[model samples]
Target: MNAISSYLGSDHTRCDDFFIQAETNVSNGAWEQAEVSLAQFTEALERHFTMEEKVMFPEFEQATGSSAGPTAVMRMEHQQLRSIVALMRDALAARDAESYLGHSETLNTMMQQHNMKEESILYLMADRVLSGRQEEIISAMTSIDAPA
Candidate 1:
Protein backbone atom coordinates (compact mmCIF):
# COMPACT_ATOMS: atom_id res chain seq x y z
CA MET A 1 0.00 0.00 0.00
CA ASN A 2 1.06 3.59 -0.58
CA ALA A 3 1.58 6.04 2.25
CA ILE A 4 -1.94 7.44 2.45
CA SER A 5 -3.53 4.02 2.15
CA SER A 6 -1.17 2.55 4.72
CA TYR A 7 -1.91 5.18 7.33
CA LEU A 8 -5.66 4.96 6.86
CA GLY A 9 -5.64 1.18 6.88
CA SER A 10 -3.58 1.01 10.04
CA ASP A 11 -5.85 3.49 11.78
CA HIS A 12 -8.89 1.46 10.77
CA THR A 13 -7.33 -1.67 12.25
CA ARG A 14 -6.62 0.10 15.52
CA CYS A 15 -10.14 1.47 15.68
CA ASP A 16 -11.60 -1.96 14.99
CA ASP A 17 -9.59 -3.55 17.79
CA PHE A 18 -10.70 -0.92 20.29
CA PHE A 19 -14.30 -1.32 19.24
CA ILE A 20 -14.06 -5.09 19.72
CA GLN A 21 -12.63 -4.58 23.17
CA ALA A 22 -15.44 -2.23 24.00
CA GLU A 23 -17.96 -4.81 22.86
CA THR A 24 -16.40 -7.49 25.03
CA ASN A 25 -16.29 -5.22 28.05
CA VAL A 26 -19.89 -4.21 27.65
CA SER A 27 -21.05 -7.80 27.15
CA ASN A 28 -19.27 -9.06 30.21
CA GLY A 29 -20.60 -6.33 32.48
CA ALA A 30 -17.20 -4.73 32.79
CA TRP A 31 -18.46 -1.20 32.71
CA GLU A 32 -15.29 0.34 34.05
CA GLN A 33 -13.10 -1.25 31.45
CA ALA A 34 -15.58 -0.37 28.77
CA GLU A 35 -15.49 3.23 29.82
CA VAL A 36 -11.73 3.38 29.49
CA SER A 37 -11.93 1.63 26.16
CA LEU A 38 -14.45 4.10 24.94
CA ALA A 39 -12.23 7.00 25.91
CA GLN A 40 -9.38 5.50 23.99
CA PHE A 41 -11.66 4.83 21.04
CA THR A 42 -12.92 8.36 21.06
CA GLU A 43 -9.44 9.89 21.26
CA ALA A 44 -8.10 7.79 18.44
CA LEU A 45 -11.12 8.54 16.33
CA GLU A 46 -10.77 12.27 16.89
CA ARG A 47 -7.17 12.14 15.81
CA HIS A 48 -7.97 10.10 12.73
CA PHE A 49 -10.84 12.31 11.76
CA THR A 50 -8.83 15.46 12.35
CA MET A 51 -6.09 14.16 10.11
CA GLU A 52 -8.56 13.54 7.34
CA GLU A 53 -10.48 16.73 7.79
CA LYS A 54 -7.63 19.17 8.22
CA VAL A 55 -4.83 17.78 6.12
CA MET A 56 -5.75 14.90 3.85
CA PHE A 57 -9.10 16.28 2.83
CA PRO A 58 -7.63 19.58 1.72
CA GLU A 59 -4.93 17.81 -0.23
CA PHE A 60 -7.43 15.55 -1.89
CA GLU A 61 -9.66 18.47 -2.74
CA GLN A 62 -6.78 20.38 -4.22
CA ALA A 63 -5.77 17.43 -6.32
CA THR A 64 -9.27 16.66 -7.51
CA GLY A 65 -10.30 20.27 -8.09
CA SER A 66 -13.61 19.69 -6.37
CA SER A 67 -14.64 20.84 -2.91
CA ALA A 68 -17.86 18.89 -2.48
CA GLY A 69 -17.01 15.41 -3.54
CA PRO A 70 -15.88 12.38 -1.55
CA THR A 71 -14.40 14.33 1.32
CA ALA A 72 -17.62 16.23 1.86
CA VAL A 73 -19.57 13.01 2.14
CA MET A 74 -17.05 11.64 4.61
CA ARG A 75 -17.25 14.82 6.65
CA MET A 76 -21.00 14.37 6.98
CA GLU A 77 -20.54 10.79 8.03
CA HIS A 78 -18.06 11.92 10.67
CA GLN A 79 -20.66 14.25 12.04
CA GLN A 80 -23.08 11.35 12.33
CA LEU A 81 -20.48 9.33 14.22
CA ARG A 82 -19.73 12.31 16.44
CA SER A 83 -23.36 12.68 17.50
CA ILE A 84 -23.64 8.99 18.27
CA VAL A 85 -20.44 9.14 20.27
CA ALA A 86 -21.71 12.03 22.34
CA LEU A 87 -24.91 10.16 23.10
CA MET A 88 -22.99 7.02 23.99
CA ARG A 89 -20.72 8.91 26.35
CA ASP A 90 -23.67 10.46 28.11
CA ALA A 91 -25.33 7.08 28.46
CA LEU A 92 -22.20 5.49 29.81
CA ALA A 93 -21.76 8.29 32.31
CA ALA A 94 -25.28 7.75 33.56
CA ARG A 95 -24.41 4.10 34.28
CA ASP A 96 -26.94 2.94 31.78
CA ALA A 97 -25.66 -0.23 30.16
CA GLU A 98 -28.67 -0.81 27.96
CA SER A 99 -28.50 2.54 26.26
CA TYR A 100 -24.73 2.46 26.06
CA LEU A 101 -24.69 -0.94 24.46
CA GLY A 102 -27.29 0.04 21.91
CA HIS A 103 -25.38 3.17 20.99
CA SER A 104 -22.07 1.30 20.93
CA GLU A 105 -23.45 -1.25 18.51
CA THR A 106 -24.72 1.50 16.29
CA LEU A 107 -21.39 3.30 16.49
CA ASN A 108 -19.43 0.19 15.62
CA THR A 109 -21.59 -0.44 12.60
CA MET A 110 -21.40 3.15 11.41
CA MET A 111 -17.67 3.40 11.89
CA GLN A 112 -16.93 0.12 10.18
CA GLN A 113 -18.92 1.11 7.13
CA HIS A 114 -17.32 4.55 7.03
CA ASN A 115 -13.81 3.23 7.32
CA MET A 116 -14.36 0.67 4.60
CA LYS A 117 -15.55 3.24 2.12
CA GLU A 118 -12.83 5.68 3.11
CA GLU A 119 -10.12 3.12 2.63
CA SER A 120 -11.37 1.38 -0.47
CA ILE A 121 -12.97 4.11 -2.52
CA LEU A 122 -12.10 7.52 -1.11
CA TYR A 123 -8.45 6.90 -0.36
CA LEU A 124 -8.07 5.16 -3.70
CA MET A 125 -9.41 8.24 -5.37
CA ALA A 126 -6.97 10.36 -3.41
CA ASP A 127 -4.14 8.10 -4.43
CA ARG A 128 -4.89 8.73 -8.06
CA VAL A 129 -5.39 12.45 -7.59
CA LEU A 130 -2.40 13.09 -5.36
CA SER A 131 -0.15 12.03 -8.21
CA GLY A 132 3.14 11.17 -6.46
CA ARG A 133 2.79 13.34 -3.38
CA GLN A 134 0.92 10.88 -1.15
CA GLU A 135 3.90 10.61 1.16
CA GLU A 136 3.99 14.32 1.91
CA ILE A 137 0.30 14.28 2.56
CA ILE A 138 0.72 11.27 4.82
CA SER A 139 3.51 13.02 6.65
CA ALA A 140 1.32 16.04 7.17
CA MET A 141 -1.04 13.79 9.08
CA THR A 142 1.61 13.22 11.72
CA SER A 143 0.44 16.20 13.75
CA ILE A 144 -2.95 14.61 14.25
CA ASP A 145 -1.83 12.35 17.09
CA ALA A 146 0.53 14.82 18.69
CA PRO A 147 -0.07 15.97 22.25
CA ALA A 148 -2.54 18.78 22.44
Candidate 2:
Protein backbone atom coordinates (compact mmCIF):
# COMPACT_ATOMS: atom_id res chain seq x y z
CA MET A 1 0.00 0.00 0.00
CA ASN A 2 2.67 2.47 -0.98
CA ALA A 3 1.21 5.94 -1.31
CA ILE A 4 1.97 8.33 -4.13
CA SER A 5 3.59 10.65 -1.66
CA SER A 6 6.15 8.07 -0.58
CA TYR A 7 6.91 6.86 -4.10
CA LEU A 8 7.32 10.27 -5.68
CA GLY A 9 8.86 11.85 -2.61
CA SER A 10 11.64 9.29 -2.76
CA ASP A 11 12.12 10.15 -6.40
CA HIS A 12 12.54 13.79 -5.45
CA THR A 13 15.35 12.77 -3.13
CA ARG A 14 16.94 10.68 -5.87
CA CYS A 15 16.90 13.59 -8.30
CA ASP A 16 18.21 15.94 -5.63
CA ASP A 17 21.16 13.65 -4.99
CA PHE A 18 22.10 13.69 -8.65
CA PHE A 19 21.69 17.45 -8.79
CA ILE A 20 23.96 17.94 -5.80
CA GLN A 21 26.63 15.69 -7.28
CA ALA A 22 26.52 17.60 -10.54
CA GLU A 23 26.70 20.95 -8.80
CA THR A 24 29.61 19.85 -6.64
CA ASN A 25 31.55 18.59 -9.64
CA VAL A 26 30.99 21.87 -11.48
CA SER A 27 32.10 23.83 -8.42
CA ASN A 28 35.33 21.88 -8.25
CA GLY A 29 36.06 22.58 -11.94
CA ALA A 30 35.90 18.89 -12.67
CA TRP A 31 34.66 19.34 -16.20
CA GLU A 32 34.67 15.69 -17.16
CA GLN A 33 32.98 14.55 -13.98
CA ALA A 34 30.61 17.47 -14.10
CA GLU A 35 29.50 16.47 -17.58
CA VAL A 36 28.75 12.94 -16.45
CA SER A 37 27.01 14.04 -13.27
CA LEU A 38 24.96 16.65 -15.09
CA ALA A 39 23.83 14.08 -17.60
CA GLN A 40 22.79 11.77 -14.78
CA PHE A 41 20.93 14.57 -13.04
CA THR A 42 19.13 15.58 -16.21
CA GLU A 43 18.11 12.03 -16.97
CA ALA A 44 16.81 11.44 -13.45
CA LEU A 45 14.85 14.69 -13.44
CA GLU A 46 13.35 14.10 -16.86
CA ARG A 47 12.22 10.65 -15.81
CA HIS A 48 10.60 12.08 -12.68
CA PHE A 49 8.77 14.71 -14.75
CA THR A 50 7.64 12.12 -17.26
CA MET A 51 6.28 9.88 -14.54
CA GLU A 52 4.20 12.71 -13.18
CA GLU A 53 3.09 14.29 -16.46
CA LYS A 54 2.42 11.07 -18.32
CA VAL A 55 1.10 8.83 -15.59
CA MET A 56 0.17 10.37 -12.25
CA PHE A 57 -1.18 13.70 -13.46
CA PRO A 58 -3.42 12.11 -16.05
CA GLU A 59 -4.79 9.64 -13.55
CA PHE A 60 -5.40 12.35 -11.00
CA GLU A 61 -7.07 14.58 -13.58
CA GLN A 62 -9.26 11.82 -14.89
CA ALA A 63 -10.29 10.82 -11.38
CA THR A 64 -10.85 14.37 -10.20
CA GLY A 65 -12.11 15.73 -13.53
CA SER A 66 -10.08 18.87 -13.26
CA SER A 67 -7.23 19.31 -15.70
CA ALA A 68 -6.68 23.00 -15.01
CA GLY A 69 -5.74 22.69 -11.37
CA PRO A 70 -2.48 21.70 -9.69
CA THR A 71 -1.35 19.55 -12.57
CA ALA A 72 -1.43 22.55 -14.87
CA VAL A 73 0.62 24.57 -12.46
CA MET A 74 3.14 21.77 -12.04
CA ARG A 75 3.44 21.42 -15.80
CA MET A 76 4.20 25.11 -16.14
CA GLU A 77 6.81 24.88 -13.43
CA HIS A 78 8.35 21.89 -15.19
CA GLN A 79 8.76 24.03 -18.29
CA GLN A 80 10.44 26.73 -16.26
CA LEU A 81 12.80 24.17 -14.77
CA ARG A 82 13.59 22.80 -18.21
CA SER A 83 14.48 26.28 -19.43
CA ILE A 84 16.84 26.75 -16.48
CA VAL A 85 18.39 23.35 -17.16
CA ALA A 86 18.99 24.40 -20.75
CA LEU A 87 20.82 27.49 -19.57
CA MET A 88 22.92 25.36 -17.26
CA ARG A 89 23.75 23.05 -20.15
CA ASP A 90 24.87 25.98 -22.27
CA ALA A 91 27.03 27.31 -19.44
CA LEU A 92 28.53 23.89 -18.98
CA ALA A 93 29.32 23.63 -22.67
CA ALA A 94 31.11 26.99 -22.55
CA ARG A 95 32.90 26.16 -19.29
CA ASP A 96 31.32 29.17 -17.62
CA ALA A 97 31.27 28.24 -13.95
CA GLU A 98 29.64 31.45 -12.77
CA SER A 99 26.77 31.18 -15.20
CA TYR A 100 26.22 27.52 -14.44
CA LEU A 101 26.24 28.10 -10.70
CA GLY A 102 23.78 30.96 -11.05
CA HIS A 103 21.38 28.80 -13.03
CA SER A 104 21.88 25.96 -10.57
CA GLU A 105 20.93 28.21 -7.66
CA THR A 106 17.75 29.27 -9.44
CA LEU A 107 16.97 25.69 -10.32
CA ASN A 108 17.50 24.52 -6.75
CA THR A 109 15.12 27.15 -5.45
CA MET A 110 12.50 26.32 -8.06
CA MET A 111 12.76 22.62 -7.40
CA GLN A 112 12.28 23.10 -3.66
CA GLN A 113 9.15 25.15 -4.16
CA HIS A 114 7.77 22.83 -6.82
CA ASN A 115 8.40 19.71 -4.78
CA MET A 116 6.75 21.28 -1.76
CA LYS A 117 3.55 21.86 -3.70
CA GLU A 118 3.54 18.36 -5.06
CA GLU A 119 4.23 16.61 -1.78
CA SER A 120 1.96 18.78 0.29
CA ILE A 121 -1.03 19.29 -1.92
CA LEU A 122 -1.22 17.41 -5.19
CA TYR A 123 0.22 14.16 -3.97
CA LEU A 124 -1.98 14.07 -0.88
CA MET A 125 -5.01 14.74 -3.01
CA ALA A 126 -4.02 12.07 -5.48
CA ASP A 127 -3.51 9.56 -2.72
CA ARG A 128 -7.01 10.20 -1.41
CA VAL A 129 -8.77 10.17 -4.76
CA LEU A 130 -6.71 7.56 -6.52
CA SER A 131 -6.30 5.27 -3.53
CA GLY A 132 -6.93 1.83 -4.90
CA ARG A 133 -5.20 2.53 -8.17
CA GLN A 134 -1.91 3.62 -6.60
CA GLU A 135 -0.10 0.43 -7.48
CA GLU A 136 -1.26 0.53 -11.09
CA ILE A 137 -0.27 4.14 -11.51
CA ILE A 138 3.07 3.61 -9.78
CA SER A 139 3.78 0.67 -12.01
CA ALA A 140 3.03 2.69 -15.11
CA MET A 141 5.25 5.50 -13.87
CA THR A 142 8.07 3.08 -13.21
CA SER A 143 7.81 1.62 -16.70
CA ILE A 144 7.98 4.88 -18.63
CA ASP A 145 11.09 5.34 -20.77
CA ALA A 146 13.63 8.00 -19.80
CA PRO A 147 13.55 11.18 -21.82
CA ALA A 148 16.06 11.71 -24.63
Candidate 3:
Protein backbone atom coordinates (compact mmCIF):
# COMPACT_ATOMS: atom_id res chain seq x y z
CA MET A 1 0.00 0.00 0.00
CA ASN A 2 1.18 3.47 -0.76
CA ALA A 3 1.74 6.08 1.92
CA ILE A 4 -0.76 8.90 2.22
CA SER A 5 1.43 11.23 0.24
CA SER A 6 1.84 8.68 -2.50
CA TYR A 7 -1.83 7.81 -2.59
CA LEU A 8 -3.12 11.35 -2.64
CA GLY A 9 -0.33 12.60 -4.82
CA SER A 10 -1.31 9.99 -7.36
CA ASP A 11 -4.84 11.36 -7.18
CA HIS A 12 -3.53 14.82 -7.87
CA THR A 13 -1.87 13.48 -10.97
CA ARG A 14 -5.03 11.71 -12.04
CA CYS A 15 -7.04 14.89 -11.74
CA ASP A 16 -4.38 16.81 -13.59
CA ASP A 17 -4.49 14.30 -16.41
CA PHE A 18 -8.21 14.73 -16.67
CA PHE A 19 -7.86 18.50 -16.70
CA ILE A 20 -5.26 18.32 -19.42
CA GLN A 21 -7.46 16.07 -21.50
CA ALA A 22 -10.28 18.56 -21.24
CA GLU A 23 -8.04 21.47 -22.13
CA THR A 24 -6.68 19.63 -25.14
CA ASN A 25 -10.18 18.88 -26.30
CA VAL A 26 -11.05 22.56 -25.98
CA SER A 27 -7.95 23.68 -27.81
CA ASN A 28 -8.81 21.34 -30.66
CA GLY A 29 -12.21 23.04 -30.94
CA ALA A 30 -13.94 19.80 -30.17
CA TRP A 31 -16.70 21.23 -28.04
CA GLU A 32 -18.51 17.91 -27.72
CA GLN A 33 -15.36 16.11 -26.58
CA ALA A 34 -14.45 19.04 -24.37
CA GLU A 35 -17.80 18.86 -22.62
CA VAL A 36 -17.43 15.18 -21.96
CA SER A 37 -13.84 15.52 -20.81
CA LEU A 38 -14.64 18.48 -18.63
CA ALA A 39 -17.48 16.58 -16.99
CA GLN A 40 -15.16 13.69 -16.23
CA PHE A 41 -12.51 16.05 -14.87
CA THR A 42 -15.00 17.86 -12.69
CA GLU A 43 -16.36 14.63 -11.27
CA ALA A 44 -12.93 13.28 -10.49
CA LEU A 45 -11.84 16.56 -8.89
CA GLU A 46 -14.96 16.70 -6.76
CA ARG A 47 -14.40 13.16 -5.57
CA HIS A 48 -10.84 14.00 -4.62
CA PHE A 49 -11.94 17.02 -2.67
CA THR A 50 -14.65 15.03 -0.91
CA MET A 51 -12.15 12.36 0.03
CA GLU A 52 -9.96 14.99 1.64
CA GLU A 53 -12.69 16.99 3.33
CA LYS A 54 -14.76 14.10 4.67
CA VAL A 55 -12.03 11.57 5.44
CA MET A 56 -8.39 12.60 5.21
CA PHE A 57 -8.51 16.09 6.69
CA PRO A 58 -10.73 15.08 9.58
CA GLU A 59 -8.54 12.12 10.40
CA PHE A 60 -5.39 14.20 10.14
CA GLU A 61 -6.79 16.90 12.39
CA GLN A 62 -7.95 14.31 14.91
CA ALA A 63 -4.55 12.71 14.97
CA THR A 64 -2.51 15.91 14.98
CA GLY A 65 -4.87 18.12 17.01
CA SER A 66 -4.28 21.06 14.70
CA SER A 67 -7.57 22.12 13.21
CA ALA A 68 -6.49 25.59 12.09
CA GLY A 69 -3.27 24.62 10.38
CA PRO A 70 -2.76 23.06 6.99
CA THR A 71 -6.16 21.42 6.80
CA ALA A 72 -7.92 24.77 7.36
CA VAL A 73 -5.92 26.40 4.61
CA MET A 74 -6.59 23.42 2.38
CA ARG A 75 -10.31 23.68 3.01
CA MET A 76 -10.28 27.33 2.07
CA GLU A 77 -8.35 26.51 -1.07
CA HIS A 78 -10.84 23.79 -1.88
CA GLN A 79 -13.61 26.38 -1.77
CA GLN A 80 -11.69 28.57 -4.15
CA LEU A 81 -11.12 25.68 -6.49
CA ARG A 82 -14.78 24.78 -6.34
CA SER A 83 -15.75 28.30 -7.26
CA ILE A 84 -13.47 28.23 -10.27
CA VAL A 85 -14.84 24.84 -11.21
CA ALA A 86 -18.33 26.30 -11.20
CA LEU A 87 -17.23 29.02 -13.56
CA MET A 88 -15.60 26.48 -15.83
CA ARG A 89 -18.78 24.47 -15.84
CA ASP A 90 -20.70 27.56 -16.83
CA ALA A 91 -18.24 28.22 -19.63
CA LEU A 92 -18.60 24.67 -20.84
CA ALA A 93 -22.38 24.93 -20.77
CA ALA A 94 -22.24 28.08 -22.82
CA ARG A 95 -19.74 26.57 -25.25
CA ASP A 96 -17.38 29.41 -24.45
CA ALA A 97 -13.99 27.92 -25.19
CA GLU A 98 -12.14 31.14 -24.37
CA SER A 99 -13.74 31.45 -20.98
CA TYR A 100 -13.17 27.79 -20.27
CA LEU A 101 -9.51 28.15 -21.15
CA GLY A 102 -9.20 31.15 -18.86
CA HIS A 103 -10.74 29.27 -15.95
CA SER A 104 -8.66 26.23 -16.75
CA GLU A 105 -5.48 28.29 -16.63
CA THR A 106 -6.46 29.67 -13.24
CA LEU A 107 -7.33 26.19 -11.96
CA ASN A 108 -4.08 24.75 -13.22
CA THR A 109 -2.04 27.35 -11.35
CA MET A 110 -4.05 27.04 -8.15
CA MET A 111 -3.95 23.27 -8.21
CA GLN A 112 -0.21 23.23 -8.76
CA GLN A 113 0.42 25.40 -5.72
CA HIS A 114 -2.17 23.69 -3.56
CA ASN A 115 -0.87 20.25 -4.47
CA MET A 116 2.71 21.23 -3.75
CA LYS A 117 1.81 22.30 -0.24
CA GLU A 118 -0.21 19.16 0.39
CA GLU A 119 2.36 16.79 -1.06
CA SER A 120 5.40 18.44 0.48
CA ILE A 121 4.08 19.40 3.89
CA LEU A 122 0.56 18.38 4.89
CA TYR A 123 0.64 14.86 3.50
CA LEU A 124 4.12 14.29 4.89
CA MET A 125 2.92 15.41 8.29
CA ALA A 126 -0.04 13.05 8.08
CA ASP A 127 2.27 10.20 7.15
CA ARG A 128 4.32 10.83 10.28
CA VAL A 129 1.67 11.85 12.78
CA LEU A 130 -0.77 9.16 11.74
CA SER A 131 1.78 6.48 10.99
CA GLY A 132 0.10 3.54 12.62
CA ARG A 133 -3.27 4.47 11.20
CA GLN A 134 -2.08 4.82 7.63
CA GLU A 135 -3.89 1.76 6.40
CA GLU A 136 -7.08 2.73 8.20
CA ILE A 137 -6.99 6.25 6.88
CA ILE A 138 -6.17 5.20 3.32
CA SER A 139 -8.93 2.63 3.41
CA ALA A 140 -11.41 5.26 4.50
CA MET A 141 -10.24 7.63 1.82
CA THR A 142 -10.58 5.03 -0.90
CA SER A 143 -14.02 4.00 0.20
CA ILE A 144 -15.43 7.49 0.47
CA ASP A 145 -18.58 8.01 -1.61
CA ALA A 146 -18.05 10.27 -4.57
CA PRO A 147 -19.96 13.48 -4.48
CA ALA A 148 -23.23 13.54 -6.42
Candidate 4:
Protein backbone atom coordinates (compact mmCIF):
# COMPACT_ATOMS: atom_id res chain seq x y z
CA MET A 1 0.00 0.00 0.00
CA ASN A 2 2.74 2.44 0.91
CA ALA A 3 5.19 1.06 -1.63
CA ILE A 4 7.32 -2.02 -2.10
CA SER A 5 9.08 -1.79 1.22
CA SER A 6 5.95 -1.29 3.28
CA TYR A 7 3.96 -3.89 1.44
CA LEU A 8 6.66 -6.55 1.39
CA GLY A 9 7.93 -5.79 4.85
CA SER A 10 4.42 -6.10 6.22
CA ASP A 11 4.31 -9.53 4.60
CA HIS A 12 7.58 -10.37 6.23
CA THR A 13 6.02 -9.50 9.56
CA ARG A 14 3.01 -11.62 8.77
CA CYS A 15 5.20 -14.60 7.99
CA ASP A 16 7.15 -14.00 11.15
CA ASP A 17 3.96 -14.03 13.14
CA PHE A 18 3.06 -17.39 11.68
CA PHE A 19 6.53 -18.69 12.42
CA ILE A 20 6.27 -17.50 16.00
CA GLN A 21 2.95 -19.18 16.51
CA ALA A 22 4.33 -22.44 15.20
CA GLU A 23 7.51 -22.16 17.18
CA THR A 24 5.57 -21.51 20.36
CA ASN A 25 3.38 -24.50 19.73
CA VAL A 26 6.39 -26.68 19.08
CA SER A 27 7.98 -25.48 22.27
CA ASN A 28 4.86 -26.42 24.14
CA GLY A 29 4.98 -29.93 22.65
CA ALA A 30 1.70 -29.26 20.92
CA TRP A 31 2.35 -31.18 17.75
CA GLU A 32 -1.11 -30.80 16.28
CA GLN A 33 -1.24 -27.05 16.75
CA ALA A 34 2.35 -26.70 15.64
CA GLU A 35 1.57 -28.61 12.48
CA VAL A 36 -1.27 -26.28 11.66
CA SER A 37 0.73 -23.18 12.41
CA LEU A 38 3.81 -24.39 10.57
CA ALA A 39 1.73 -25.30 7.55
CA GLN A 40 0.30 -21.80 7.46
CA PHE A 41 3.73 -20.28 7.89
CA THR A 42 5.22 -22.40 5.15
CA GLU A 43 2.41 -21.56 2.77
CA ALA A 44 2.67 -17.85 3.40
CA LEU A 45 6.45 -17.85 3.31
CA GLU A 46 6.50 -19.76 0.05
CA ARG A 47 3.96 -17.36 -1.40
CA HIS A 48 6.11 -14.43 -0.42
CA PHE A 49 9.15 -16.01 -2.01
CA THR A 50 7.18 -16.79 -5.14
CA MET A 51 6.03 -13.20 -5.44
CA GLU A 52 9.58 -11.99 -5.24
CA GLU A 53 11.03 -14.59 -7.57
CA LYS A 54 8.29 -14.33 -10.14
CA VAL A 55 7.34 -10.69 -10.18
CA MET A 56 9.26 -8.33 -7.91
CA PHE A 57 12.76 -9.66 -8.52
CA PRO A 58 12.44 -9.78 -12.28
CA GLU A 59 10.98 -6.30 -12.37
CA PHE A 60 13.75 -5.00 -10.20
CA GLU A 61 16.43 -6.75 -12.20
CA GLN A 62 15.09 -5.43 -15.53
CA ALA A 63 14.67 -1.91 -14.24
CA THR A 64 18.18 -1.84 -12.82
CA GLY A 65 19.83 -4.18 -15.32
CA SER A 66 21.68 -5.88 -12.51
CA SER A 67 21.09 -9.60 -12.85
CA ALA A 68 24.08 -10.64 -10.71
CA GLY A 69 23.29 -8.10 -8.07
CA PRO A 70 21.12 -7.96 -4.97
CA THR A 71 18.33 -9.98 -6.52
CA ALA A 72 20.77 -12.79 -7.24
CA VAL A 73 21.97 -12.79 -3.69
CA MET A 74 18.39 -12.76 -2.50
CA ARG A 75 17.56 -15.68 -4.75
CA MET A 76 20.43 -17.67 -3.37
CA GLU A 77 19.31 -16.88 0.13
CA HIS A 78 15.79 -17.95 -0.71
CA GLN A 79 17.07 -21.34 -1.75
CA GLN A 80 18.95 -21.70 1.48
CA LEU A 81 15.85 -20.69 3.40
CA ARG A 82 13.81 -23.21 1.50
CA SER A 83 16.27 -25.95 2.33
CA ILE A 84 16.07 -25.01 5.96
CA VAL A 85 12.30 -25.06 5.77
CA ALA A 86 12.43 -28.54 4.35
CA LEU A 87 14.59 -29.66 7.22
CA MET A 88 12.16 -28.11 9.66
CA ARG A 89 9.31 -29.87 7.97
CA ASP A 90 11.11 -33.16 8.26
CA ALA A 91 11.80 -32.52 11.91
CA LEU A 92 8.17 -31.68 12.46
CA ALA A 93 7.04 -34.85 10.75
CA ALA A 94 9.39 -36.95 12.81
CA ARG A 95 8.34 -35.18 16.00
CA ASP A 96 11.96 -34.43 16.66
CA ALA A 97 11.82 -31.46 18.99
CA GLU A 98 15.56 -31.07 19.25
CA SER A 99 16.04 -31.04 15.52
CA TYR A 100 13.15 -28.70 15.04
CA LEU A 101 14.46 -26.27 17.62
CA GLY A 102 17.91 -26.31 16.12
CA HIS A 103 16.63 -25.76 12.63
CA SER A 104 14.22 -23.12 13.83
CA GLU A 105 17.03 -21.22 15.51
CA THR A 106 19.04 -21.34 12.32
CA LEU A 107 15.98 -20.22 10.39
CA ASN A 108 15.36 -17.31 12.74
CA THR A 109 18.93 -16.15 12.45
CA MET A 110 19.01 -16.51 8.68
CA MET A 111 15.71 -14.75 8.31
CA GLN A 112 16.91 -11.84 10.42
CA GLN A 113 19.97 -11.33 8.25
CA HIS A 114 18.09 -11.91 5.02
CA ASN A 115 15.26 -9.58 5.99
CA MET A 116 17.63 -6.82 7.07
CA LYS A 117 19.24 -6.95 3.66
CA GLU A 118 15.88 -6.76 1.90
CA GLU A 119 14.14 -4.21 4.08
CA SER A 120 17.19 -1.99 4.23
CA ILE A 121 18.76 -2.35 0.82
CA LEU A 122 16.86 -4.38 -1.77
CA TYR A 123 13.39 -3.02 -1.08
CA LEU A 124 14.70 0.51 -1.08
CA MET A 125 16.39 -0.18 -4.37
CA ALA A 126 13.15 -1.62 -5.77
CA ASP A 127 11.17 1.35 -4.55
CA ARG A 128 13.63 3.71 -6.20
CA VAL A 129 14.09 1.91 -9.50
CA LEU A 130 10.55 0.69 -9.94
CA SER A 131 8.94 3.94 -8.93
CA GLY A 132 5.29 4.57 -10.05
CA ARG A 133 4.78 0.86 -10.75
CA GLN A 134 4.29 -0.05 -7.10
CA GLU A 135 0.59 -0.80 -7.36
CA GLU A 136 1.02 -2.99 -10.40
CA ILE A 137 3.79 -4.88 -8.66
CA ILE A 138 1.67 -5.32 -5.55
CA SER A 139 -1.25 -6.48 -7.63
CA ALA A 140 0.92 -9.03 -9.36
CA MET A 141 2.27 -10.17 -6.04
CA THR A 142 -1.25 -10.64 -4.67
CA SER A 143 -2.57 -12.38 -7.73
CA ILE A 144 -3.13 -16.13 -7.60
CA ASP A 145 -1.26 -16.50 -10.84
CA ALA A 146 1.76 -14.66 -9.49
CA PRO A 147 3.31 -17.94 -8.29
CA ALA A 148 2.75 -20.77 -5.87
Better of 1 and 4 by TM-score: 4
For residues 1-148, could you state the per-residue lDDT of candidate 4 as single tens digits? 5699999999999999999999999999999999999999999898999989999999998998889999999999999999999999999999998999999999999999999999999999999999999999999998834234
1-148: candidate 2 lDDT, tens digit per residue: 9999999999999999999999999999999999999999999999999999999999999999999999999999999999999999999999999999999999999999999999999999999999999999999998988899
TM-score per candidate, in order?
Answer: 0.92, 0.99, 0.97, 0.96
Query: If the candidates were sorted by their TM-score against the true structure, best first, what order would they fall in?
Result: 2, 3, 4, 1
> Candidate 2: global Cα-lDDT?
0.96
Q: For model 1, how big is the CA root-mean-square deviation?
A: 1.6
Q: What would the per-residue lDDT of candidate 1 be over residues 1-148, giving only the tens digit for each residue?
A: 3568777889888877877787678778788998999888888888888988999999998877898988999999999998999998898788788998899889988988998899889987887888689878887897667324
lDDT of 3: 0.92
Clash total of candidate 4: 0
Better of 2 and 4 by lDDT: 2
Model 3 lDDT per residue over 1-148, tens place: 5699999999999999989999999889898998888888888999999989998999999987889999999999999999999998898889888999999999999999999999999999989988988888899989986678
Worst 10 residues of 2 by lDDT: 138-147
Off by over 4 Å in 2: none
Better of 1 and 4 by lDDT: 4
Q: Look at candidate 2 and give me any clashing residue pairs.
A: none
Rank all candidate structures by their lDDT, best first, as comma-separated numbers.
2, 4, 3, 1
Per lDDT, the best of the predicted structures is 2
